[model samples]
Target chain A: MKVANEQTTRDRIIETARQLFLTRGFAGTGIAAILKEAGVRSGSLYYFFKSKDELLVAVLDQYKGLLRPILIDPVEAATNDPIGRVFALLESYRGFLLETGCRMGCPIGNLALEISDTHDEARDRVRENFDAWCACVEGWLVDAGDRLPNDLDRAELARFVLTVMEGAQMQAKANKKIKAYEASITQLRHYFEMLESRAK
Target chain B: MKVANEQTTRDRIIETARQLFLTRGFAGTGIAAILKEAGVRSGSLYYFFKSKDELLVAVLDQYKGLLRPILIDPVEAATNDPIGRVFALLESYRGFLLETGCRMGCPIGNLALEISDTHDEARDRVRENFDAWCACVEGWLVDAGDRLPNDLDRAELARFVLTVMEGAQMQAKANKKIKAYEASITQLRHYFEMLESRAK
Candidate 1:
């Protein structure tokens, strides 16, 4: 019971920090801001996180944990057809973008832009998350098997898909248009169909 | 003579602010930091720009002004063939990326991530820059002439192309791999080819 209470406080701190980080960015957000927003008070925030950086790292981890399933689960479950799975994954992302009304950029991509050189640990985490994502994409391509080109490179394809998704989301948010995201998915789907036809 | 001196000082301040903002981001960088890095006195920094936010807006303007030619000039010159112009513009960006070692994210994209919602004027500049860029792309598509489908929506296609380019750049920078960017361009070229074929 006591552990649960402590965990709840920790979770609240993470939630508040994540929101602030997404809305204001890491540098703009401070420990005091997180503490005040979370209503945890300074001592409690320090008790859970040693510093603002540590809190930001914790918030990043929390985001990663939340996003992995949102991003990967659809692709993972659509194990039946690799190409279909890839499309489904993208479609799911499109749905999310539409629902959110295109507010925030990809949290992972945002961190990548914000912390590439200044923070080694953060950079590594961002890279690891991206690699894991690419691995899932690579797995889907492998499942596509005979349908994909005999020489189709899975890693390269995954990277391309990720790039489109990340970039499309940013564009959609910037322009406040769902069509931007849809356009990427449409082009990707067209490309997939072309690849499948070439296999025949 | 007074105006010239003032312009030089202002230009110096904006340039220094641009480099710092790109490297450290908005919140991580302060006016004091800008003055120190630019070797300009604090009084001079403030004499030209009213506040940190004002300086950030100027930095954003500088970013747009700098990127305009680097991104748009090639496309503008290759006017004879819209499709060709598109590829040439992208190729030029690749050269820039290679020259710089892909150290910084797209400046406008970076600022969009940092302050899109938080700063309205800054966001408007980002929007205008992107809109202008999209217009440049649309002009290329229009020039692609009958090679593109009569019914093919050029605006949508332009947005899609922008998404892929921006996303590819971000992914490439995040992983420090040129392959990511290369893959997107390759696919994009393929996409243009498909449009050409379908139009015919």
Candidate 2:
């Protein structure tokens, strides 16, 4: 029972910090804010996380764990066509922008740009998140098979998709509009059409 | 001469803040660090700018001012072909990544993601930077004219280019390698080729 309570406290702290960090950014968010928002004392926070940086690591780990269930699975289930799945994944992001009024972006991407230069462990975790994202898209491209050009490098294309997604989110957030996001995705869709047309 | 000296001090502070903010992020950098690095006192900093946020506006304005000479002119001078100029502009960013070992990304992009949620003034400035960048590329796409399909929406394609550049930089910085950057450019190049081949 004690262990269960401890686990709940840890999870609560991580979840609260995740939301705070996502909206406020790692450097912009402070420990006091997290403790206050999480409804925890300083002792409880330090008990679970030795420092705020440690808490960041926990949040990242939680993000990694949630990627499949929270992010990929829902989108993947919405579309069965391999190429369509690729785009459905992007649409999920567009949905996020709409829901947040273009205020929130990809949590990992937000941190990737903000903390990459300062935090090694957090940076590596960000990289892993990116790699995992790319790998999922790559699988779709590979499954796309001859519908995409036979010579098409699936891995590189996946990276491009990731780039488009991240870049689109940045523009959308900056302008506080979905137009930039829509425009980029439209261009990406055009590129994919060209690729498919050139298929073997 | 006294006025000129004051102008020099202001420039120095803005320049130092620019570099620090680029590498460290706006939220991550403090006024003390900027004052120490720029060799200016608090009195001088406060005299010129009321707060750190004000300093950030000045830094953003400095970036906006330098866009023509430092960013666009060199690339424009290097290429007469409109399409080549677009690639050349991307190449300049590649050079930055290589020189900085991928530690720094687009200063405007970093700020766009970091400050868009909290700082309205900073967010607007970042949006202006993106608009300015997109306008330059849109000009090139316009100049390319019939060489690209007439059906191509030049404005949207320009946005995609910005997306690719910002996204590429994010990936490069996260991975601390140029491979992701190179891969995205290559995909963008391939997309361009398809558009040109389908030219009117």
Candidate 3:
């Protein structure tokens, strides 16, 4: 009973809504579906969040917290090399796509296009999530030091990695095939080699 | 008036729906709004299309018709060099971001994430749209001939360009800024240079 307290209940709801939004999209997901999946009644959900949009904000906020702990740390632990870590981060997403059969894309990216204009609060949060993601990638590039060309804009390159991932994921899911995702990443790999070669 | 024929009414409805779906998203848009925007009554809309989904299919069909004429042809007119045309295609999207202040993204891309999963008909259409786009870019790469590395996967490179554009647009729209898109395209330009230099 102690484990199923207010905070846990609220977290459970947010997690459920986040998954639904990623797979089904914000507009397509119904409140009843969230309630059903979270195993909470309407009253319980209403207690924690005023509306579905608030739950979305909470989900996005949770994403900010999860990025480092969930996605980055595990990949970082697997590889100490900064450049390897970047690809490892991308591969982690590949693993998810494989598991889901390329059905879901980057959560933040999914919401970014689906509701960014209609939902202002969520839009800023989406931008924050993106900023945080690019920052992580940029930090790795900074750590790479002499490995990459000095003239290379690390921030821009980092964002490019993100762009590649989001775009690849969209294509993969749309085509229902992993090959589409692979093609994009393979080109990115070549681009990285060219950057490293120029540095040398 | 001869101008208001059945075909014109149908095309007008599709054009209005395409704009709304791109700007507002598939799930967020309602039939009434499409009718209002198209300046047609519900009877006329239903006369041309039986359901909202049918209208969406019509919009997607029109998209296939519009891509070559609206996007690629104009960009091709600007440059004879195949490589220049690739960047020109990307720059055209940048122009769109600039005009709309980074609001709407790639039309097919927006629908890909929004309705592709929920609507199978739309999903296939989205995939075909992506395939057609990639084929166009691939044709340009083939036209580039020995200018690029012989070993380079031109089909993969073509898809990568699409990935970069779609991803850059999504980021630009979410950030409500054009610089995000510019950063991605700039990085892509660098990648192109690397490929060309390697060939030389």
Against the true structure, what is each candidate's TM-score?
0.87, 0.97, 0.96
- Which number leads on DockQ? 2
Of candidates 3 and 2, the better by lDDT: 2
What is the lDDT, from 0 to 100, of the residue B84 in candidate 2? Answer: 97
Give interface RMSD, per candidate. 1.6, 0.6, 0.7
Off by over 4 Å in 3: A1-7, B1-7
Two-chain DockQ for model 2: 0.93
Report the CA-based lDDT of candidate 3 relative to the real structure.
Answer: 0.90
Off by over 4 Å in 2: A1-7, B1-7
lDDT per residue (tens digit) for residues B1-200 in model 1: 36535659888889888888877788778778888888899989888888888887887777667655666775666666668787777787677678777766477777777777677787778888787878888887887779988987888788878888888888767767677889988877766776677778
Q: CA lDDT of B86 in candidate 3?
A: 93
Which CAPRI quality tier does the interface of model 2 achieve?
high
Lowest-scoring 10 consecutive residues by lDDT in candidate 1 chain A?
A1-10
Clashing pairs in 3: none
**Per-candidate DockQ vs. reference:** 0.59, 0.93, 0.87
Local distance difference test, each candidate: 0.77, 0.92, 0.90
